[model samples]
Target: MTNTPANEKWFQDRATEQIHLEQLQRAERFNGRAAMLGIVIGIITEGLTGAGIAHQIGLGPLIDGYTACRTQFLPFCF
Candidate 1:
């Protein structure tokens, strides 16, 4: 347990690493919360729209376009 200069530097390095790890953990938690909020918002929007409502929002055209593309690019798709 000698309080040598190298020992002090090692302790400082570990402390810096620990601080970085804690910061990363906090950031991850914040990211998880943001993702959950987005999911909740999406669910609410989808529920408000109700089932079989995509046609009202012009998704029929989008789906038709996708179908056409898929049909054209059969090998790329399947």
Candidate 2:
């Protein structure tokens, strides 16, 4: 039996492809977890800020004032 260089090259190529695929899967899972954590932190931060603002200027009045200003003010900020 003769072992050819072409056969060796084919095996090496397949091994490289598999390693790259594994690395890609690991990166995707890491990114997904990071995104979920970021979203949770963002929600908590927004809730805390809103609560602090309400406490400073009465909850009911603050909400009413925000509702009134939002229609006119949000467009410019966005």
lDDT of each: 0.78, 0.76
Candidate 1 regions exceeding 4 Å error are 50-64, 71-78
Give the alpha carbon lDDT tens digit for every residue of 1-78 in model 2: 776999899999999999999999999999999999977776776587764434444586667567767777554422
User: What's the residue-level lDDT of 21 in candidate 1?
Assistant: 100
Off by over 4 Å in 2: 51-78
Cα lDDT, model 1, residue 48: 81
List of clashing residue pairs for candidate 2? none
lDDT of 2 at 19: 100
Q: Which candidate is the best by lDDT?
A: 1
Query: CA lDDT of 18 in candidate 1?
Result: 100
Q: Write the per-residue lDDT of candidate 1 for residues 1-78, one digit (tens) a residue.
A: 779999999999999999999999999999999999977776777788763335445687667667877789544542
